[model samples]
Structures are given as structure tokens and as C-alpha cells.
Target: MLSLPATLTQDHARECLEQLTDGLQAEAAQVVVDAAELRQFDSSALAVLLALRRECARAGKHFAVQGLPQRLRDLATLYGIEGLLPAA
Candidate 1:
């Protein structure tokens, strides 16, 4: 599982994304992104997940999110990206 840090703001998007990518590249099972700690996020934070999903697809791997906060769920829907972060 991709455990998110205490926060997921724009300040750490790149660094966190890199760490996530590293974990993805080394994992044998499906990449499960854990977002339980992502309390508040903006467009940049959203981009990080989108980019990771793209990278996973490019490398032919399964990707799904875990513990997504309601704020994020609403953001995805508001931005027309709910399809990317389906329930569960």
C-alpha cells in the first residue's frame, strides 16, 4: 500500500510522487495508494495522483486508491475526475 504522509499539499507533491513511484516500481502486487492522511488538497495534489495513474498504466500495472477523504472525493467529482477515483 502507498501510505501517504501526514499531509499532501503542493509543497510535497513532487517528493511524495517520487517516493510513490519508487514504491510502485518495486511492488509485486497491485499499487494501492493510501490517502487516509490527505486532509486538504488542491489541484496540484490531484495532479500527483493523475500522473501516478498514468505512469502505472504506461508500465502495465493495476492502480487503485485507498482511504480517500471526502474532500478529495468531492474534488474529483467537481473537477470531472471522479472516474479516476472510483469508490473503494
Candidate 2:
């Protein structure tokens, strides 16, 4: 598992997505995403999580959001993917 630093939103999201996709293929299991430290986020950033889940499913590996912040939860709820992440 790796924690993504949210400072560089787009880059962080993309890098995390790539790592998840690549790691899942080799690991053959879900890679836990630690979003506890995330301070800020946006649509594109959240989409990476969605894309990761999809990619992991397509690759036959599970993926989950771990230690998500409440702020993120509300945003995800607004985006309709709230259930996808761990509760704050």
C-alpha cells in the first residue's frame, strides 16, 4: 500500500492510478489506497480512484479506498461514488 500526497492533484492522481493498475496486475490482489492524508481533491483526482477500481476489476484484482477523510467522503457522495470508499 502507498499513500498518495494530494498536493499535486493531477500528477498524484495519475501516478497513483498507474501504480495501482500496474501493481494490481502483478500482485493479483487489491492494492489498498490510503487517502487519509488527503487535504484537497477535485473531479479529475476522484476519477483516478474510479478508474483504478475499474482497471483493477478488468485486471482481476480488487481495489479499495482505505482511511479516507470525511471531506472526501462528502465530495464522493456528491459525485455518487461515496460507497466506493471507506467511511470516515
Lowest lDDT sum, 10 consecutive residues, model 2, at 2-11
Candidate 1 matches the true fold with a TM-score of: 0.89
Model 2 misplacement above 4 A = 26-28, 86-88
Task: Give the root-mean-square deviation of each candidate in angstroms.
Answer: 1.4, 2.6
| Cα shift from native, residue 48, model 1 (Å) | 0.8
Which digits, one per residue and each the tens of the lDDT, describe model 1 over residues 1-88?
7777767788889998999888888865477888888776776777888888888888888788888888878888899997886443
**Winning model by TM-score:** 1
lDDT of 2 by residue, 1-88 (tens): 7565655276576776777567565553756777877777766667877787787677776677777777767778898888775432
lDDT of 1 at 24: 85
lDDT (CA) for every model shown? 0.81, 0.69
Candidate of highest lDDT: 1
* Span of ten consecutive residues with least summed lDDT in model 1: 25-34
Q: Evaluate model 2: give its TM-score.
A: 0.74
